[model samples]
Target: MLTITLAQADGSWENPEQIRGAVAAFVKAHLPGNAAQAHVAVQGPAPGLRFPACRQMRMGFFGYSNPYGNQTVAVTCTTPSAWTIYIPVQLVMNQAVVVAARPLGAGTLLAADDLSIIRRNASNLAGSAVVDPQLAVGQVLRFGVAAGQPILASMLDAPEVVHAGQEITLIAEGDGVRISTIAKAMENGRPGQTILVRNSSSGKVIRGTVDQAGAVLVPF
Candidate 1:
């Protein structure tokens, strides 16, 4: 059996199974003759992470070729008793190494054997949180990500902070005593829309429209 230990090549604390799985894919490509065996180790995992077993029972087949024939097998793993464990296996006429591991004692595997299972279970694998101006990378993806989630490139142009129900005074084109005072009922006011206002002296309520200067226009 060829045993390979997973070491931290990248600074991120990535999922151990994900890293090992990539290596497993590599091994599948270089299988000797028509059969091969591999033992994978993941070291320095957070405490409580369990070792996985080699999958048993033919679950199904994926990625088929007409000339090379089809593969049908189960993907399961044996649990680790201590920090490290071995999974023994036998195979014929196939070059495929797939590793599935969980955090210490995390009993479930990362990706399922079935494509439908992955679609129903796994989150975005190719998505990134970072935003790009040229490419619309930060837009929320439904069922995969949310919409209107702020983007980094547009963050520099975030809307100015404004308060709701705040009173703002604008000099009236008429008498200063009857100056227009608007109470913002909501943020992002629209032009030519009626807004509520209060008379500073008489405490009376009046309706006015937002004008070009972002000020309420009262004709009285």
Candidate 2:
């Protein structure tokens, strides 16, 4: 609903500023997501290019799915004269996202101090960029990340909670009764992952899900 003021001394030809303003307003209304900061850059019409003054103007996105990045908008006029013009518009949307606070190496266990949230242009960021510091914390980096670089989901992995041949607690519960025993993990396992383990007392192999506390829960 935001529009720019039109200053036309003679209502004879279409004003380039008017066209640019219309495109800017339309983009702002259709932009996706709540951007922390938005900037719309509209290119002016070429010099000497003139069209008859239109009583009404209609604007629409030209060959674009969403109002983001570099795009073209088609402006049509019908009343005094029927004409269409394509105006180029650039949309830069900034959003808060998680980024590495300092240079980190691969296999580094991320902690709260390793990350910081900052506003960055959404278009310039990867689609998998992490937005929450909690998501990056306690996770292991799959690759080295540069200082001040945005942390991406693909760059992290769940830390391995159970390692091969490691001793771990195995718990089983059923019918209001609980049982726990020492077990040796047969293979490495991450949080919530199921892996085979051998009960130390019985020497029996069983499958159990690794919990966040590094304990394995088996079926009763």
Candidate 3:
């Protein structure tokens, strides 16, 4: 067991348990996400270590340490004597995140059954994992994911509405005049994405934005 001592103005010693509790509370209050999910383990001062009586005390995180995982807290004493000590802390926070239920191939359209929600250590995650099933469902996978692998936001993409070699209507409007032409898409594109199209009528290549209706809109 570790013991830390703090002295009040009356010369009464503060309980070491209170000091540990205070440090845990301080870390929890500053942690991001749900504080209730965080578990903090604060290591007390070294054995037989003693600090002089202090009328005023302040505590803060030392250096560039993050709020979670292994960290250090600096305790500063002010008043009759001024001193500082570093306390080690361990923090773990579990959060629900989406993961693949089975090995899914690249380009596969995700469905509700393809994903599962599980509690994982947020501090150890490599990237921001998807949390909502609705956000993953109907989305196309950019790369293959193994079973039980956490699904990151970068791994999913919007379904392509226009495919290469598909015939689509290209429309351009300016000065109250609107023109439409049939064109072939040069590449796959999702809604709102710019793609190259070859106009069948003029035999010319043009860039246009794919619309929700699957048509390409050329800027004037």
Predicted structure with the largest lDDT when compared to the true one: 2
Tens-digit lDDT string for candidate 2 (1-220): 2223344426789878777778888877777666425798888677889988766778777885454467788888765678988888776777778999999999999999999999877665545678889999999999898999999888988999899999999999788887999999999999999999999999999999999999999877
* Worst lDDT 10-window in candidate 3: 1-10
Model 3 clashing residue pairs (backbone): none
Work out the TM-score per prediction.
0.22, 0.63, 0.71
Model 2, residue 186: C-alpha shift (Å): 6.0
Greater-TM-score candidate between 1 and 3? 3
How good is model 2 by TM-score?
0.63
Task: List clash counts for every candidate, in order.
Answer: 15, 0, 0
Q: What is the Å distance of residue 123 in model 3 from its true position? A: 3.1
What TM-score does candidate 3 get on C-alpha atoms? 0.71
TM-score of 1: 0.22
lDDT of each: 0.34, 0.82, 0.81
Clashes of 3: 0
> Model 2 segments beyond 4 Å from truth?
1-10, 64-68, 78-80, 94-96, 117-120, 128-132, 162-220
**Stretches of model 1 off by over 4 angstroms after superposition:** 1-163, 174-188
Using lDDT as the measure, what is the rank order of every candidate, best first?
A: 2, 3, 1
